[model samples]
Target chain A: MPLARRIIPCLDIKNGRVVKNVNFHHGTWDAGDPVELAAMYDRQGGDEVVFLDINASWEQRSATLDILTRAAEQVFIPLTIGGGVTAVEHVRSYLRAGADKVSINTGAVKDPDLINQSAEIFGSSTIVIAIDMKRRPTGGWEVYLQGGRTPTGIDGLKWAEEAWRRGAGELLVTSMDADGTRNGYDMELHQALANLVDIPVIASGGAGTLDHIAEVLTTGKADAALVASIFHSGQYTVDDAKQYLAAKGVPVRR
Target chain B: MAARIVIVDYDMGNLQSVRNAFKAVGYQAEISPDPASVLHADGIVLPGMGAFGNGMRKLAERDLIDPILEFATGGRPVLGICLGMQLLFEYGEEYGGGPGLGLLTGRATRLPDTVKLPQIGWNLVEPVAAAHPIFEGLDQPYYAYFDHSYAAADVAPADVAAVTDYGRVFPSVVARRNIIGIQFHPEKSSRVGLQMLTNFGRIVCHSRSTLR
Candidate 1:
């Protein structure tokens, strides 16, 4: 089956609030009540919702899902919870709690085997591999894990292909260099990875407007584009985003 | 005064919009974690998202399980949203092995790999039964938003109310007795979506007067 294009709204939760971090820097960034934030996205026609907890620890991770639970309680939409997920058991717990799927980054790379085990345990369709990439002049994009702090040295396209082979059902590629820049998605990175595998790729970082979303899907050939800063700051609603995509001849829930 | 309706809180999410949706139709909704509020409600909405095991754990942790089960079984009108709908089943594939409220006689399973795990977007919803009161005035194949990998098919065919296709056919709305559930967000589906909520609100007001 072809992967459906997604209009996902992301919430970076910290201390029960929706937040966003730039350049992977840890400053006290705060967005208001998570429940209210999620509800706004739902009303605006967001397809899927993601809550990435900036507080990366075992106990703090549970708080993220709790926020997801609280938001899920109000918004009848698909929820994907990430952060501090290090094992297959964590994936099961999140999915059962109400998350349609679970996303992993540092954990999957720290232990490359986690992807295989998670896919085997919960099925590949339930697992999403989130990749943070930085432009490496040596030639291909280099993979960044650990919230864009650690470098994996592996070329993104190769790793993405291996991830799908390892049982990851989808890929979420975030361009660390362009993240929060509002310039645009890394077209070079997106183009190289789009055709390398059958799994859908969620273009993350550098989305400033509806046109950027359209550009990524049309030019970059991605199935979905993950937007944070644009939607989080109220620059646009998911409905407006969908309208723009639909106008551009892209399939969206309008 | 219209029939009084209350949302089961238990510190569960979605109270604001559910309240907002009800308010949009000129009705006020109260978010109460109180068991008495649920028991006395003329129409009740139980909304959920997130994981089933933790939600059930929270229900048990907050001592809300029996109260919710009691209200649904006692014939007070109750509507379960998303995960709330999933919890009504006998069990879920999540958390390895956990028991549900058993309000509906079936288990919920994650959609297999052949279909996208989380079927996201404004896909079409088709009513299988001949337009029940809950579905009054709703356009067939109207679009509603969905976000989840697990769905209900294990329920008896008689209980199924609506079905939507997403690489595979699955139950989107199910009703039995006074219970009803919509997998898509009626509150988020724009005009058609809002109309469904308006219909639900009217159902709450007409079926009971305490909601006013």
Candidate 2:
């Protein structure tokens, strides 16, 4: 059999607190303490945790790493850190501070070679390429940077293929269209990228129920699904989603 | 005294988390590149991550290649993790080809991209040897977290303690005499992981008594 599908809980951290905003805009909503929330998720059998420093600033980075270090002490699963990671030193700092993998977005776009450089130095498995895309009026999605506010005008799918070619171990694709909608993942977006790249794709944004997760994993072909508010607000736990998916014959780590 | 577990820090594996796991299990753990620490430890954990060539280079640079072998041959317990596990073998096909520590007769090669690169996530571990003490109270088909693009390809079946299924069945855990290696990260595997480390500590304590 293949590796079991992953259920990752994402913590949008700002100033050491877990916070979230609708569609990556408007106002931030307080979630909880990142370290405490991560501990709870670890207890609930989360396959992994993605801690994105959503503020996208370098000044707050040391604070984020401090939280990551403390959180690493309490949790034993793989922890991935993203946001404001611009160079190999940033990657080293996060890994040294206890992150198993570092996800790059804006830095990678500004310098595509950053992917190759970081991958060469830290190994590909330690680097993740996160692409934030919003549905364009003209058709295909456009890649967004700076916390999904600035449009790079680069085709999301094309950029994803390039990132993979440059040695990114995995891709975390978030859909702005589906963000905060609770409708479901953009199956078309996910399927297209999943087929375009051989590396694993983690589908994020637009998740309200377990069926949505199952759909993304099975029909959507995402190797993993990243969920936020539903889990953060206690609407359902990671275990609830795993059990629901397992019942549906989707192989999930229990 | 608690088992003095020293993590062989050749600057590869996430030694901090590995140390934390052992500490959680009530064992004294330290990440040390010092040869004296490896020689005097009650047990040793050689932990590593990243490319096989780089890992080997680090070991050679630190002049740890022979001391590690000496520690293993001395019959005190030693555990290798992930790339460290791959390094225990004879050869590695990563980045063309390179020699490993040759502690075990096997080759480390990349997993097929037909499944996915860097097969990441938790997968169930099925024991090939049913009576090993490392898995004493763990359930069959127990889940463990794995993150790697390559795995041991040609190890002896006798050396395999457990196998995990990805695209093909690969040796997830291998052991010979006082040496043990696990492809999965026990430090990142939660409950099953803590128990496994505790079992390793027990093995170390038991062997120390036998030596006395």
TM-scores of the candidates in the order shown: 0.65, 0.96
lDDT of prediction 1? 0.77
Candidate 2, B78-138: lDDT as tens digits: 8999998999999999999899999998999888767776887788899888688888897
Tens digits of per-residue lDDT, candidate 1, B1-212, equal: 65778887855544565665677667788888887788787888878765678778888887888888888877767788877888888998876858888898787777777754566556777888746777888746667776677777678899988887776777888888678887776765655666777777877776675433
Candidate 1: residue A238 lDDT (0-100): 87
Cα lDDT for residue A161, candidate 1: 88
Off by over 4 Å in 1: A1-4, A26-29, A92-98, B1-122, B126-130, B145-212
lDDT of each: 0.77, 0.90
What is each candidate's DockQ, to 2 decimals?
A: 0.11, 0.76
Q: Which ten contiguous residues of candidate 2 chain B have the minimum total lDDT? A: B112-121
C-alpha lDDT (0 to 100) for residue B108 of candidate 1: 74
Which candidate gets the maximum DockQ versus the true structure? 2
Q: Write the per-residue lDDT of candidate 1 for residues A65-113, one digit (tens) a residue.
A: 6775566456656567788788888887776555656899888878889
Superposed Cα deviation of residue A191, candidate 1 (Å): 3.3
Q: For model 2, what is the error of residue B46's alpha carbon versus the real structure, in angstroms, after optimal superposition?
A: 0.6
